[model samples]
Target: MRLRVQGLYVMDASKRSAHGNAYFTGFGKAKRIVFFDTLLEKHTLDEIESILAHELGHFKFGHVRQMILQAAIIAFIGFAALYWAFGSETFAGWFGLPHDPGVVLIALLFAKEPVSHLLHPLLAARSRKNEFEADDFARRIVGKEPMISALTRLTRDNLATLTPDPLYAKFYFSHPPVPMRVAQLRGAVEA
Candidate 1:
């Protein structure tokens, strides 16, 4: 499994905030991993390696490409919907909107808000599943204890929500809460 990681660098994020994070970005040969300076300050080398492994899991699973494709499909659907709305006078007339392109476009923006909200759970669920897969991949590479320790430290240092409401998490959280992730890692170790 060749990652073809192009660059590894740290950013001076502490100048603005103390939040700690690491991320993998780009596609194919352009891939890069970046760590917030604050993360280096807060975590041990082992923890950092665990986090790096987790980021690499995203690359291993092709999550970046999957996300890009999902975005493209959504954008295409949105444009198609807009085109249909523009041509359909009944759609505009239903809301007493003028059968004009500009007016219909404005109405579409308002109309899409509810649909976006409805779609939030599905999108967030996929994102959270990807996060779990990444966590598990890191566990496989670096051991669950290190990954769990890194996650625990990240949650504490970042002042993350400890226990979000289930419904809220389902709808909004792109990653499982720290405690949830830690529990899953611990369970995986036993199994």
Candidate 2:
């Protein structure tokens, strides 16, 4: 689908695949955004536009840059910790590994999960905030009705429960709850 917004053409493509899920790629040189065609088929044009607006919000608000910086910092800290831990004979012997090259490799591989687990909650919270900012941008550009309807359809199609545990929502949900989003939109429309 090609959407002309603000004198630029946003082309949504569908060729990128990762772990059986569709990935969207934006080409700065071409000034186009490519996403899975299945998304287009499943959503109305207005909904698609809202999604695109959300993506543009990320671009406009420097969320992508923030994410890149966060990843870099995490990687640096992870590598530093792994290096320090692996250098200690006590740490190596505790994990049943020899103080050798193999031990270093094993530490690198095993450190990923622990690091990810430690950072998951903070990352999830940041992600949810970004989603709300994007939604606000989409609402401003496409109006509350289209964005709310689009969000509802997506929640229903994705089999997302209307209600979820607040703890789970804070720890995992990237987007706000459907009811909360819809209510916000409705309030905006009424105002």
Candidate 3:
């Protein structure tokens, strides 16, 4: 993992938002881990290390590449749909608009919410599963307590929902609710 890491950087994220976050960017041996300055200020060194371990898990599991591939597939489908719509004179006409690219784009914008609604559950489920795997990996690397503490702080600091409607979470959440994650961590520890 050390060999794969290219750099570690701290961004002045506090200037934009008080929310704390960290992420790894690039791919393979060129990967860089970037931490929000707010995260540095708010968390203990141990907590930061736990977060780093979680990110490392994503790399180890190739979650990043998988996400990119998923996005590419979605984009390809979207572009294909757009191409089809362009050729169909009835596309814009369905929206009571002219058969122009600009008008079609506007129609697509209006359609985006419903389309996203249909796709969100599947995408969110995959993302949540990845998050759980990452959390487990972090537990293996740094133990569960530090990661749990970090999650607790992040939830409080970010004003995140501790619990949410199950259906709503299925529709919109990419990560499981904090309480849910913490329970899973504790359960793993007990196991």
Candidate 4:
């Protein structure tokens, strides 16, 4: 992803990796930001700006640092769990797995999948809260109408349903439901 400010665009090299799944473009000269093609499609100015504003919120609130710290903590915990679970030959034999540290590390990483799945809802809920905070920030800066219109357009473009299962949303979503978001914006506008 890229961030632009005063004619300069900053993008991490990792963004170009084959595993890259997100992209952002901003008017460096204009000090404007944009994120492209995630759950939302690129279409209409309002949609683009709304998404951009949300991303800008991340930058504004230091969410990136929070994400990094969270990842590091999780990784450390995962490693500790792995070590404790397979520290002994007897333990390895009990599981019928190899006793090699390298093999154990790999297995540990794979074993974390279920743990990750179980933690997904909590993570997604935090993410959704962050999204809401960003939306709130965007509305404050750009006015509720633009952000609302942008959100609506992007949701439609992305084929996001107006309503989603609460359980599924908690488990899988990183943003609030579109209708709820729009309502928030509207309420802000009315207030």
> Which is the leading candidate under lDDT?
1
Model 3 root-mean-square deviation = 2.7
Q: What is the lDDT of residue 145 in candidate 3?
A: 97
Collision pairs in model 4: 7-28
Worst lDDT 10-window in candidate 3: 182-191
At residue 103, give the lDDT of candidate 3.
Answer: 86
- lDDT of the candidates, in the order given: 0.90, 0.68, 0.87, 0.65
Q: What does candidate 4's lDDT look like per residue over 1-191, in tens digits?
A: 45545532334433453221222223325543333333333345665555567667776765665766777898899767776866767645666887988777676677678989998888887777777777887887777887887777666655668889977877898778888788777774321
The residue pairs found clashing in candidate 3 are: none
How does residue 190 of candidate 2 score in lDDT?
21
Deviation in Å, model 3, residue 86 alpha carbon = 1.0
Q: Model 1, 52-147: lDDT tens per residue?
A: 999999999999999999999999999999889988998899998789999898899999999899988889989999999999999899999889
Q: Model 3: per-residue lDDT, tens digit, 19-114?
A: 999987777677888999999999999999999999998888888889989999999989988888889988888877888888888788778789
Stronger candidate by TM-score (2 vs 3): 3
Compare candidates 1 and 4 on TM-score and give the better one: 1
Query: By summed lDDT, which 10 consecutive residues of candidate 1 come out lowest?
Result: 182-191
What clash count goes with each model?
A: 0, 1, 0, 1
lDDT of 2 by residue, 142-166 (tens): 8888888777777776677889988
User: How should the candidates be ordered by TM-score, best one leading?
Assistant: 1, 3, 2, 4
Model 4 / residue 158 / CA error / Å: 1.4
The positional error of residue 88 in candidate 3, measured at the CA in angstroms, is: 2.7
